[model samples]
Target: MNLLDENNRHPTAITDNSAYDGEPTWSPDGRWLAFASNRTGSGEIYITPLEGGVARQITHHPAWDENPSWSPDRDNPRIAFVSSRDGHFAVYVIDLAFVPGAGLPAERRVSPLEYTAFDPSWSADGRTLIFAASLRGHSEIYAIDIDAAPSADGYAMRPLTDGLIDRQQPAWWP
Candidate 1:
């Protein structure tokens, strides 16, 4: 998983030996690279260096952890991703600065604690995130303001699409 520079020099293997790997994201500072791999017998997110080195696992579970989106804030280095640890697929987030790896601290499930959510895309403002979820048994798009503290009931998720053809992939306009 070695990444090349602009000059196509300084090649290195990001992962020593991994069966699957994809969705690599560089930190805002461009110091580290985060990606998903199934090397531990189950798909999990891991972070490595663009300069080449052993990767660090960021999620641990029998379920799959895929599609990592790094926060634009470099100090915190938060990562947003999807996971199936709760039987149903949902989105989650973790702070790389405080949580060194998958085992540093428990991963935070940022999606609706009760609803199924997946494929999260960050908003340009970095205070919001867009993801796909089911409401009233109908799949649609949703947006949440992470900056606002979630009520005890749970975080707020507003539907963006009506009950009709599924809106597969969603991205906020630049």
Candidate 2:
């Protein structure tokens, strides 16, 4: 993978891409990067400090995980990514605070089981999460409040768009 400075100039190779590595997301402080790689045979999320530190694997699931989205909360960073652990690709949220040998960090499934979701993006407030999912039909962007109580039928996913218009990777405005 490569890292570029502001204005998208001066590209620098950050990692030796011996394995498939992609979907890089930067921490709020811009000191570290979180990306998915298949270095260990199965796709997993890993974070590497920009200052010559080794990359540490944050996720260790048998199924592949990808598309990591770091939270804007500098105080307590979190990663939201998609995984195929449950047979279908679903979104899961895990804390970015991974101790070198603390084992797998705690994570929770954020999307409903019925639909396959992808491209998780955090809201500016870090209180809501949005992703693209299709329920046996065309994909649509859906948002869910992470801290809000679950609704009667489970997570209250609010659809941001409707009809046949497709959308993916929703971003938040300041």
Candidate 3:
């Protein structure tokens, strides 16, 4: 899919696939573009040069993986996303540099906090991660401090908004 610049003049394909590609998020450094594509038999996250080239699949799963967001600093090298490889859908995180070309060797499952977690949005500062988690039969927003890695003790997550209604898809404000 092509995305237009703010001036609505410059257009970019973001991906080369003629099949289906969308949800393109540029790398913080502006060198690579990350997006979701189904051209590889199943929907998975693919990264390509911002200038455009053969897209490389970043995820390999029989289940779908979508909503990929890059971290602010390349040094940290992290991509937050949602994957349904497990029986139920959940949130996952993978190291861009740590995972080999074969695709994410092993995705760190971050969901199933209360029920299931999906739609993760990384903080611009890159210290926290906010995502939607289904709890008590309803979806809610939750935030975790990535700076403090989750240990055997467990990471603390708090609801951004407390309510009984459903909430899905979360984006952080700069």
Candidate 2 overall lDDT versus native: 0.88
lDDT of 3: 0.78
- Candidate 2 runs further than 4 Å off: 5-11, 97-102
Model 2, C-alpha of 74: deviation from truth (Å): 0.9
- Candidate 3: tens digits of C-alpha lDDT, residues 62-174: 88888888878667777788887886677777777775665464457776544677888898887778998886788889888765767564655767988879998888877
Superposing every Cα of model 2 onto the true structure, what RMSD results? 2.5
Error of 1 at 1 (Å): 2.8
Count: clashes, candidate 3: 0
Residue 140's lDDT in candidate 3: 89
TM per model?
Answer: 0.84, 0.89, 0.85
lDDT of 1 at 131: 89
lDDT (CA) per prediction = 0.78, 0.88, 0.78
What is the per-residue lDDT of model 1 for residues 1-174, given as tens digits with 9 covering 90 to 100? Answer: 666655868765666674888888878778788899998889899987765567888788899889998877755568889998988788898766674443473468877746778778887657788888864565688888776788676876677888677665678787
Task: Name the lDDT of candidate 1.
Answer: 0.78
* RMSD (CA, Å), each prediction: 2.8, 2.5, 2.5
lDDT of 2 by residue, 9-126 (tens): 9988878868988999999999999999999999999999998778989888999999999998887689999999999999999975654455667788989999899999998868
- Sort every candidate by TM-score, greatest first: 2, 3, 1
